[model samples]
Target: MPIKTPDAANPCVFISAEDVGKVGTETPQELAGDLGFLSNMEMIRQAGSFRMGVTPDIAAAKQMQSVPKVAIVAAPTDAKIQSGKVLLGTDVDLVVRMISMQQPHRAVPITGALCLAIACRIDGTIPARLARATLNTLTLSQPSGTIAVDANVRYINNTPVALSGTVLRTARLLFSGLVHH
Candidate 1:
């Protein structure tokens, strides 16, 4: 199922662990600071490979040129969420991190949050494996804080085929003036 943001701009498709190469890889004893970033890059590369009908080796050098060159990953249990606004409680089922094509790859965008929440409900996805069974709400532990999303999953033939998710995020306009470049 594809997850689209409220603006209908960013569309995300969930990929399986096998596709992302997380199936046979050993779970790291400790998640290095850049582990998620590296993983996300790899996922992006893999997606690019699939899109271009090539191997990851060739895609690694050219993945950055691909459209929608970004990826998000669900953080494992060991990784900690560094945020002062919200305390990390036991209810945190998933932690989402965004990796983009630009610098400062790590981020916690609202769209990514919604996508992660929806992905959690889908079976066989990385987020689904880590997510706890919930009726509708999912608390995604991001770097900034936790985002709560209301999601509904529709099943077909015992498989998730569609998802509807909504999240309320507080956005403040820091600066709104036109700038001369």
Candidate 2:
């Protein structure tokens, strides 16, 4: 099941699966592209409006709808700019445990992860990758692609505090020109 983060800034949802193939089905690949459905406000609206407890048919999380959990499922580097182009999907499938979706990216969003990072501290929250006592990074797989979120969560007085959440991304030169200031 996917849990919608309570965050209002950069809303996101987290879920778990058995493998990557099952992860991509959230959109069912009918309308979205090979990159999968775009994770943006559209997804947020769709999920927010979902009936939640009641819905005999139709999945609230479209791409994820009715897809049986089979399997589950990122990285980047620093540079002012780089040559590599961002691609959709990965060559290797994952035996992943948890996944996330954030706006402007079908993949994982660092901002989204921040919300989850804090949520993880809550008492009732199900720990992502429960097998591990500590989770330093979170791998999120979606229809379009996947990515890893770098999380630095600190604890104070048994309360979880979010220090930082980041993602490394390759940069492409979008424009290079001189401007008269």
Candidate 3:
């Protein structure tokens, strides 16, 4: 499922319940840090099983005048990490949250960033075409970072990388013999 493009000031990403339950993720701090300037240590928040936080930016302001940023990134854990499989059950509903740091005057779509992350994770490559599609469809500017093909393990309510694939394989195998002609 595609993520919705949030308003300029308060951008967020939302996926279907099914997708959220299937992907396994790393600790919120690790994902945040890996995202470079988007994560901050002090803004981290733990609510029930979900983790919420903000990113701090001193350099971004000096660098770009037209980017929507949140001094924080938040992730809610929808599944537990076990044998590289994130169970697709109702117990967990993972969602990634980010706030807009850009001045209200400048309209920047922050949810595009989250959408890009999800697209890259599912395809293992962020094609320029796809990025372009996202920009066009979401009505947002193209972000800076290039989507390099790398080994990514997004925990919690992030992307469904290799671990999610592994889990899917297992499920298919389990049903393989049962659904016979």
Winner by lDDT: 1
- Could you give the candidate ranking by lDDT, starting with the highest? 1, 2, 3
Where in model 2 is the C-alpha error above 4 Å? 1-25, 28-105, 108-110, 117-124, 130-136, 172-181
Cα lDDT, all candidates = 0.51, 0.37, 0.28
RMSD to the true structure for each prediction, in A, is 8.4, 9.8, 17.6
lDDT of 3 by residue, 1-181 (tens): 2223323222222332233231223333333445432322112211100211112343323343223333221123333332444433232222222223322112113343444344334443322222222212221111111111222335456634333111111123444355668
Candidate 2's error at 132, in angstroms? 6.5
Which regions in candidate 3 have their CA more than 4 angstroms from the true location?
A: 1-93, 102-181
| Candidate 2 vs. true structure, TM-score | 0.39
lDDT of 1 by residue, 44-127 (tens): 655654454443354453543432434434443433444334434465666554444433223456665666666677777666
TM-score per candidate:
0.57, 0.39, 0.21
- The residue pairs found clashing in candidate 3 are 25-154, 25-155, 25-156, 26-155, 54-71, 54-72, 55-71, 55-72, 69-101
| Candidate with maximal TM-score | 1
**How many clashes does the backbone of model 3 have?**
9
Off by over 4 Å in 1: 1-86, 102-107, 170-181
